[model samples]
Target: MPHCVILYTPNIEPKTDLGALCRKLADTMLTVRDEAGKQVFPTGGVRVLAYPAAHYAVADGKGDYAFVYLNVRMGAGRSAAVQKAAGDRLMEVAKEHFAPIFEQAPIGITLQIDESPGQVYDGKHSSLHPLFNK
Candidate 1:
């Protein structure tokens, strides 16, 4: 499972279409392929969520600075190269998406990928996955 969570300053939300960003990110995740050309991330296991931080400060709290932090968590299986490539692509699209905002204000965009080899406890119950698998 790959769950992408995006956190950004609320100041950027006015000029950002976060819903579109989420869709774009999810779509990009679906396109990641391994060396064998198999999908790196299963279609049903991908999720993108975004949140805007209403109360926050940037830099010395003097300028209008905004930040976008994207944290991607997934089960471990892929190689380091594969993960880096995916992260690169995701960051590329994210930069492209916020280009407008960048020009209008001071902003920082970051993407991080976390691979979980094993969890102490894990659980899942969903019918949505069946739809994608089928």
Candidate 2:
């Protein structure tokens, strides 16, 4: 599951489109391919969800500041290069999406990729995978 969870500041919601950003992120995830050029992440398990923090405090509560923390979680099995590529691509897309707002407002964006190390317990129950496999 390459689930992208976007935690952004509420202030930016008015200046940007979080829903469109999520869709773009999901699209970027699908473009991440392995060495053989096969998709690195399964299509059906991809998820991009954004949640604006109901309340948050920036580094200093001086001015109206905003931030977007994007974390991409996936099952481990790929090389570091692949992970880096995905993170780089995702960050690039996110940065481009928020460029306009960044020019007029003080906002920050952070992206991280967390690959499972085979220790975490993951339960599976999804009918969507079958559709994609076909």
Error of 2 at 19 (Å): 0.5
Which pairs of residues collide in model 1?
A: none
User: For model 2, which pairs clash?
Assistant: none
Question: What TM-score does candidate 1 get on C-alpha atoms?
Answer: 0.96
C-alpha RMSD (angstroms) for model 1: 0.9
lDDT of 1 by residue, 18-97 (tens): 99999999999999998899898888889999998878988899998999999999788889999999999999989999
Give lDDT per model, in order.
0.91, 0.91
Report the Cα lDDT for residue 37, model 1: 98
Off by over 4 Å in 1: none
lDDT (10s digit) by residue, model 2, range 10-103: 9998898889999999998998998889898899999999998998999789999999999999888989989999999999999999999979
